[model samples]
Structures are given as C-alpha cells and as structure tokens.
Target: MEVYVELTYCMNGILFIMTYEMISLLLNINWSFLKILFLSFLSNISIVLIYIDYLPYISFLYWIVLFLFIFKKQFFLYFPVFLIVYFSILFFINTLIKESFIYNGILITPINYKDIVIVVMTCVFLIIETIYLIYAKRKIKPKDDLYDVTLIFNNKIYHLSGFLDSGNHANYLGYPLIFIKKSKIDTYQQLDTLIIDGLKKRKIDIILVDQVLVNKQSLRNVYIGVLDELDYDCLLNKELMGGII
Candidate 1:
C-alpha cells in the first residue's frame, strides 16, 4: 500500500508538470522548467488528501484552489486544457491500454507498459506545442532585436513583445523613454500628460509604472510613453541595454 501511494505521488507529479508545460506553451507564457517543476511539486502535495476519508472530493478542490492562485485570471484558460489532457490520458489508458489498473484514482501497477502511455502522450503533446511555438515565434518575432517585456502598472501585469530601436533616444529629464501603443495604457485614468517637440509638438500620456522588465532585467519606476500608433507593442530604447538613462 505504501509503495502504491508513492508510485501514485510520482505519477501525479509528472502529470502535473507536463500539463502545466502544455498550458504555458498554448498561452505563449515563458515559464522556466524549474518553475514548472516547483509548482508541480507543490501540486503533488495535494495528493496526500487522497488518504483521507473524503478521497477525491477535497483533493480535487484543493487542486483547483492551487491552480487559481497560481494562474489567477488565466485559470479559466488553463483549467479546460488540463481537464482535456488529464481525461484523455485516463480514457486512453482505460480503453486502449488495459494492462494496468487504477484503484481509488491511483495507479497501483508496478512500473510497466502503463507508464509508457504517459511518456508517449507527453512527448506527442510537447512536440506539437513545440512546433506551434516555433512557428508562432518566427511569425511574430521576425527580428533578433525583439525582446520579451513585462510591465506592472495600476496593480496589473502586462506582458508585451518589444522591438529594440537605436533611433528611439527620447528621454524626459534624464529618464529614459520607451514607447507603447496608446490602447495598451489608455485605459489607465491616472496618467500624467507631457508635451514633447518633434516634427510638430504633440501631447502624449505618460505614466511611471511600478516596474518594467526588459528581457527580464528589472527597471524600477520606469516611465512609459503612450503613442497613438506603433508597429510593435513596445519600442525599446537602446540605452536600456546598459542601464536607465
């Protein structure tokens, strides 16, 4: 019984890791493998509830809460994919590969052909997702100067793809300026307006966000310049590579 419980825990951990990776790929979220492994470890801890009298009920609820906490508003998107992959695996094992047995939502069979099903399914999904990710990245990110940026403002997080441009030397009183689409930050009500001289003088909305991450490097209290039109979601300042201007 103890060995069966341990096997179930191990299997559940692997499933959780693969499921999380699938969702990340589908959403194009850049999460490190170590982060996924850590989350999976935390999620596997919920399997301990299986030993209780309530069995799967409380255990499942605990899992949902963990998912909600981790994914936040994105939980809705993640949950459906999780359900589909999880149930599909179970269905395939139960109907097609009936060599092993599942007792009380736990795989009790010794390591055998049943384990291969999980590996094969994981490989298939990962390969498809990898191909899609490669194609999408190539389509969206045509240049090597593109970067992944994260911004925190108004207590919200925004992920954006940024293009590096050396010509963007715009600065305000020694602070570097990065341009983003107006639609992205226009919804915020508390932005300070600024006038800058260009081909013609124009007013632009500016806000000092809580933080900005350019290629994962932290820039605290960074000023974001909102523009009416931009080809990329963000225009990265060349000076940002060195430090704040």
Candidate 2:
C-alpha cells in the first residue's frame, strides 16, 4: 500500500512539472525547469490531504495558491483558462490509458500492473504535449512576419513582439503611423486622434513616443496609433523601414 501511494505521488509530480512547463512555453513565458520542478514538488505535497479525506478541496485550493503566486497580476485571467485546458488534457490521457489497459486484459490493482500503467500514461502525455507545443509555437508566431521591437517612452524601455503589417500605411503629417496594443502602454494624455478606415471607420488616439526600435533599427519621431483591438503587441509600418532596415 505504501509503495503504491509513493509511486502515485512521484508520477503525479512528474506530470505536474511537465504540464506547467508546457503551458509556460505555450503562453510565451520563460520559466526555468528548476523553478517548475520546485513548485511541482510543493504542489505534490498536497496529496497528503488524502489521509484526512480533504484531498479534493485542499488540492484545488493549493494549486490555486500556486497559480496565483506564479501568475501574479495576471492570476485571475490565466488561472481559469489554464485549469480548464490542463484538466481536459489530463482527462483525455487518463481515459486513453484506462481503455488501453482494458483492451489488453490487464487488471489494474494497487500492487499489480498499475505502476506500468502510470509510467506509460506519463510517457504518452509527454508525447502529446510535445507535438501540441511545436504546432502552437509555429502557428502563434510565424518568424517571417514577426519582428523584435523596443519602445522608449516616458524614460521607460519596453520590449515587445511586433508584427510586420504591409497594409498599415496610415501616416500623420509625414511621419508614418505605428499601431500598438492599448493595454501595453499606460494611460497618457491623448495628443490627437486619427480616423482609420477598416471594416468600420474608427477613431484612435495618436501619441508620440520618444523613440522606436524595429528589428534593432532606431526611428525617431514616429506617430503611434493606439488600438484596443490589436492582436499583436505592436504593428510595424512598412514605410517605417524605408530609410532604416
């Protein structure tokens, strides 16, 4: 009985660590393997709640605390999303393993081939996660159209991922216009406004930043159009690269 419980704990720890790492990569967050391992270890400790019959509630609360610690300001936004996806993948893998054992006529007992099932389940989970991560990375960020951008405004330096958009030819008084995500920048006094003709005619605020760096090339006095509907962090103007590429 002790051996069975120990094996379950260790296998669960491995799964937790892998899941966190996979989610981090998918979200474009840089989390070290060692840090994830440590957090997973702590999370696995909640398994002890099983002895007191408080396993489910305590385990859920413990994981919520950990997620809050890791995600900080984005806790509320990311926790529910992560929880749903994580459990869905977990349920799929669990069902797969159970069906495989039943089809093979392998009886799962605490001291029987349960260990083998757990190990095989973890391996299968890793394989599925690897494939999904690779596919998501390519689809979410295509290297050809993305650029590394640095914005210096209000004496603060901000690094962002920019998408090169050829259609964004809007300019203001000769200076090319660059569209940025409204949430990325703090609230600033709106200097002026520009009406953009897209699917709908919408007026966006125009603000001037001190300097903008697109793919390491610096451009000064560029007009910035803040859009609430921007998908990427920044949208690079094709004309902005005319003089400096």
Best by TM-score: 1
**Total clashes for model 1:** 0
lDDT by residue for model 2 (82-187), tens: 6765566556545644432211111122334764766776777776876666576567665788888999888888899898888988788887889899989887
* lDDT of model 1 at position 40: 72
lDDT of 1 at 217: 77
Query: Which regions of candidate 2 fall more than 4 Å away from where they truly are?
Result: 17-42, 48-56, 89-109, 135-140, 147-219, 223-245
Clashing pairs in 1: none
TM-score of 1: 0.51
CA shift of 50, model 1, Å: 0.8
Provide the global lDDT of candidate 1 against the true structure.
Answer: 0.70
Listing every candidate in turn, what is its Cα RMSD in Å to the true structure after a full C-alpha superposition?
12.0, 8.7
